[model samples]
Target: MAVYSYSKLETFKSCPLRYKFTYIDRIKRPGEGIEAFMGKRIHEVLEKLYADLQYKKQNSLNELLADYESRWKANWHDNVNIKKEGLTQDNYFEMGRECIRAYYERYQPFNQAITLGLERKVVFFLDPEKRFQMVGYIDRLDQRPDGTYEIHDYKSSNTCPEQTDLDADEQLALYQIALKQAFTDAKDVELVWHYLVFDKEFRSKRTPEQLEDIKRTTIETIMQIEAAKEFEPSESSLCDWCDYPDLCPRRKHFYIIESLPMNEYANETGYTLVNKLAELEDKKKALVKEIDGEIVKIKEALIAYAKAEGVDVIRGATKKAKVKIEEVEKYPYAGTPERKELEALLASAGCLEDVMKASLDLGKLAKAVKSNIWSPELIAHVKKFAVRETECSVTLSKLSERDLILDEEMSY
Candidate 1:
């Protein structure tokens, strides 16, 4: 049985290759950002506060701040990197302290509900078959005097989520199932989040139907992860903070060049060459357009002369030009009399399928066959009556000026 968590499911959705690297391959990287370090320390302080409350002992604000500072100093290490620019390690450390102090002030005396568990681990089966298990830890679980359960989570980030975002939260929704199972009398479970940095609290509830929908969606996501053969990397702004950049095939080159000297990296192989090629390609397209306009004007003059002389073909030094007119049939509307007549005739002749099949884009049909959306038998049937046409295209080449001049002389 595969175990799922909110982070695990979110990781796969954000980038399947990252999930594969973290969960499947079990690649380990050392060190973490200062933000995560601060969050952990704050979570410890909050957990301690609740644990003391469970014992009928209230921790004063000064006592809590003292414990927070002590832990912050004790766990501070060299590997914790600061991600924001122009900020030192002390800035984040103090920021976390301020968040804890604000939280303590807002919810002082800490006796809102009866404490059930601190940093409680909850696990529940998402399906009746019990093939998929969801596991997560609630920051604080409490029961009110009225027997309503509350699942609390703490956030140390500077930004607070919107109300709609909290309403759609999956972690607490999954926890609701565990709460219902653990406490048979549990009713009207509420999801609560403390945005510590902002000293704000958000609450929402999930209906039974919503929880069912979440279960179905989670199971479907897990099945996708199980069936996925190619876990392609998804590049985004978050790649900068990814721990496996050196191991990732898509990002390894970037990390390697980032370590190189600026001048050397700038002149690295194909770096400037590709840029110059792009510039030259743009110039070539502009020149082609100009030359095509001149060619059209010359061709028009030749055709006018040929028509005056009652000639179909005009011979040049090394090539010949001919003027011809073609007649084409148009069916602009489906409700038109001509189109209706054609449709009736085709239906009576039992060739409507052939006409419909012929109207399909051959390239898209071939792609559908390749992707197994359409079977080979269908492709073979279509091939029996399909007509193949070849088209030739010409484009300006990225050659030296001297070589282009020499080629032009040879053409004449």
Candidate 2:
């Protein structure tokens, strides 16, 4: 038996495939793209500013951004496709500087307040069955001489929602819960969702009834995750932020490709393809649009070739068109040349042995695959879990046991 954290538990809750990719396969996500990195960089600068108040010194927003510029840099991309990725660091720094200034101009007027901790890496056990690791470098935690704890999370996202969105977010609840756990001696914990964009703020709370409602839903989510048939997506705008967009079956085209037959490739899965010749009449409108694009492109290309070669071109010319350009994709498991090549590549990369030997947890295997996301920091985060990053929600077949950790003796 091994321990699990709330994030690990939540991974199972959100999507099982992601959990497997993160935990079982031991794959790591590459650094989050530009927007995330910039937000993080700005947060670090603000954290530093608040911390510096201990020395009785304050820097203006321009000075802070200038400091970031003094150390920031940029890069370019030159990769072949499929795995091609890049970042625009100069653009990021400027955005970061702008966000920093706006946040600063809003908060600079407030008194030099008490800061509980900035950039605090807190590890607290909510319960033996629910350990959590919170990396919220809170912007500020002020004590009102009356003794109430405030939890503030910084945001740089566009389109800040109204009270309704705050009422729906689980993070504010989770953060307050974590704050309560961290300051065990404190009596009350209040949460403040601070949106640095357009200088917006909202507060949320759990009345006894509201807390019960949240509890019931959260537990239901946990149960649903434990009984899921697959790693379903959380499914929302959040999908855009996900690093594994292609892996998700929730997206429209990806779903069509996965769940439906393409063109005339029929299967015996009871999902009939072109079974109704009558349906062709219904699709005549769509067919017209398709022909206009696909057929017109070929006709235009041929006309351009005739013009370039000095051959006389004719309007409405009747020409034989190629039906297929190049379309021969092989299955992942079917014993084809493509499959064989992939198997060889996997073997060369040591992934073949891991998969063939079935030495990994199946649930986690269901979660994620990060082909190019293994950074050192991410590796550390994934290894922190006792369970593989995550497992299949519906069924957990692979169970690897760990040694029971012995407790240490106390010094008298």
Candidate 3:
């Protein structure tokens, strides 16, 4: 029954655990990324510009920049995180200022289109029964002289997506749906994204058919969310920007101990254990070559001794080394042309399934299960014969200075 936004849908897609923590549990976390802060500051400036234009008061570039600066300083706090190395708050502030400047210089006098609304709140149903509802705020709504309505979204991010991506974007497109529903003359609606950092504008329009399709897909997504029982965490590079790392099962330990002082961190139990294991592994690898060479020589000598003595077993004080000879068939190595042809022959003979059943690769089966490559029914059928087990592995990598300094300001 909760009113959903584009961000909510996106959060669910990105990380279901995060979605649960945010919208379901309503957990409040202090601090936010500096990138978001800069975007907000830029959005506020643009909102003010459109709002003032409606009141017949046009603000100059300097006035707008001053306003932006004031807002930034007022809202700036110590907890605002800057994740990128070699970037300071001043860099972001200047970037935001430049964004405002670029926008102002490009669209001075503000007359290309009539400003209809600023930070316009839009709520609309994705279904006829009004069951799945979506809400979003348009950065600026404009109606041009030709009666073409434009839903404008402001982006302060440095990277501008390709046109193809914008064409498929759903946020402004959803707002367009709302615009059409609200205004009768909104037939010719355009979705516009102002990439302020790049001083660029991208435009796309959703066809009636596309709108209907999106609604259907969105409703399906909502249904999936509603029916979800286990909201598993999806970890990716984006996890670095996630706010609930401390609550995430995969990241909790790292979150808890990452801020410890070097002395304490070095002595930490898990760290020391992993370090010792890695050290032992390195020593093992270094000795493996020499040991392997000696083992090969001894094995050859043992074989000769066993053949000369006509004995299959050679005994020491308390142990016996058995030399047993057997012939084994070897097929063409996997991925080779011969192997492929052999596979094709077997498949043509209708023996592929039986062969697969005879020597099934559990790794491949597990991968298929994790990737959901099979239907639910097929997965359940296969899962009946499989017992889930946890496999722990340790990989060694030299820690960077940045890793040691992760969340240096994190207290709790």
Clashes of each: 0, 17, 0
Task: Estimate the overall C-alpha local distance difference test score of candidate 2.
Answer: 0.55
Task: Judge candidate 3 against the unseen true structure and give its global Cα lDDT, from 0 to 1.
Answer: 0.83
lDDT of 2 by residue, 192-284 (tens): 776765677787765545654654565565555556666645665555555565555556444345555565335533335444655776689
Estimated TM-score for each candidate: 0.69, 0.52, 0.72
Per-residue CA lDDT of model 3 for 360-393, tens digit only, reads 3445555665677656765564455444443322
Top-down TM-score ranking = 3, 1, 2
Rank by lDDT (best first): 3, 1, 2
Give the CA lDDT, 0 to 100, for residue 379 in model 1: 43
User: Which candidate has the highest TM-score of all?
Assistant: 3
Which is the better candidate, 1 or 3, if ranked by lDDT?
Answer: 3
lDDT of 1: 0.80
Candidate 2's displacement at residue 199, Å, is 1.7
